[model samples]
Target: MSDDDLSEKVGYGHPPKKNRFPKGTSGNPKGRPKASKNVANAVELELDSKVTVIENGRKLKLSRGEVIAKTLVTKAMKGDLRAFDAVTKLLPKRFREPLAEANKSEPLDPYEAEVLERYISRRIAKEDSHD
Candidate 1:
């Protein structure tokens, strides 16, 4: 069919010429604002900003991202299971493997060991009673 014929047949997918957008005009005249940043870009900028952090009883300046990462690792080290999993997932595979190995070889703190012993004894007693 001729271009004229195709243009004339306007029902569902097409609009009549009078209703169509003008040749030199845009559908969105102002377009996206120049000041707007997408979510990823905004997050990156925020994470890269520097902030004060306290470590080893000293206040130090660090990037916000670094502070967050240190907090996650500290929470993991304090026996927070969810934090441990989150830190493991966030680390590079090579770093995660070494950390896992070190954790396995390292002895638990005295309090942690005592807690584990109590938990095990209680679990055993509960199972024995059930049986």
Candidate 2:
């Protein structure tokens, strides 16, 4: 046998061209199904589904996301610190804080002003206590 044929016979990593996979075919044709949705898509579908919830002794139907948000807010209001953090995280960035504008002079509403004052005071107190 020629050295080329001998090397092909004992090739370490390279498979013979003829016996290798065809140009377009996948190595794992039976692998994960093409229609399988990813985690985010699955979660979104789940959250979009409606569920029954009780509010003020009245049964109401709401999306899973709404139910979850309500539950998180209720827990946070009841002093669950982790839930508070989760609720904050779930809020849109703009809702969490006012967007900065260089030229806009939009006045803060009473609630917004109160919240801002409380936030600033807490931050200042925290900084003072750290010193």
Candidate 3:
């Protein structure tokens, strides 16, 4: 039966008031947890160490604290700031500071970072292939 029929069958004369969240309010108070914010933050692993090193000498330290990042795939595809910022993943931590501080140090030359660039390109291409 419809709501009206159910109301009639209940014989309460009127139906109970419906409930809903307030406008612009989220039901989840804690909100969603974030990804890693900085590369230095530490995280916990159930069995093993939480730290994980990526390609080359790049290392990515996880964080239990909140972050301000979206998914890496989207960042790569959009070529957003994070995409450019992510080149730190190729070099060691010590190299990153010096490179950024260098007078003539070149930015991550997408063409020069062949292996990583190609890998990203292939992944993106594959993702797009289905569409």
Candidate 4:
């Protein structure tokens, strides 16, 4: 069809000229806000933010990230299995491998150990696949 004929056809997948935005103008003129930060930047800002907490009768300043790590470790120390699992996952491979090896001799609950092994193996496989 000719350009004129195509432009005039406005039933489906096309809108009437009067309803369309004018040529050279935008559907969103203002576009995304200039002040908006991306997710990574926002997360970095939040993790880097300072927090004050009383530690052993003394007030101490810590980053939000540090506070989160402290809380995770504290919960794990109190026998929170989920928190312990999280801590183990966050540990570097050097530390984690040795811990996993040590667990073989220490005798973890059979079911629990099997589940943990499966989870770690799956995580490692996923990470390797990504690489």
Writing each residue's lDDT as its tens digit, candidate 2 over 11-96 gives 67777767789999989999876786789999999999999988999999999999988889999999887898898787797876
Regions more than 4 Å wrong, model 3: 1-43, 46-78, 86-91, 101-131
Q: Flag clash pairs in model 1.
A: none
TM per prediction: 0.47, 0.46, 0.19, 0.52
How does each model score on lDDT? 0.88, 0.86, 0.58, 0.91
Task: For candidate 4, write residues 1-131 as lDDT tens digits.
Answer: 67986769687878877789998999998897787778999999999999999999999999999999999999999988899999999999999989988777856799989999999999889879999
lDDT of 2: 0.86
lDDT accuracy of residue 61 in candidate 2: 96
Candidate 1 residues 4-123, lDDT tens each?
867596888778877999999998999977876789999999999999878889999999999889889999999877899998898799898888787787678999999999998998
Candidate 1 wrongly placed segments (more than 4 Å):
1-36, 97-131
Candidate 2: stretches off by over 4 Å: 1-36, 98-131
Off by over 4 Å in 4: 1-36, 106-131
User: Model 3, residue 31: displacement in angstroms?
Assistant: 39
Best candidate, TM-score: 4
| Candidate 3 per-residue lDDT over residues 1-131, each given as its tens digit | 57775654333554343544567978797888898666344332332344453535766664322122334545666776556567457547898878768756666676779978898899889879988
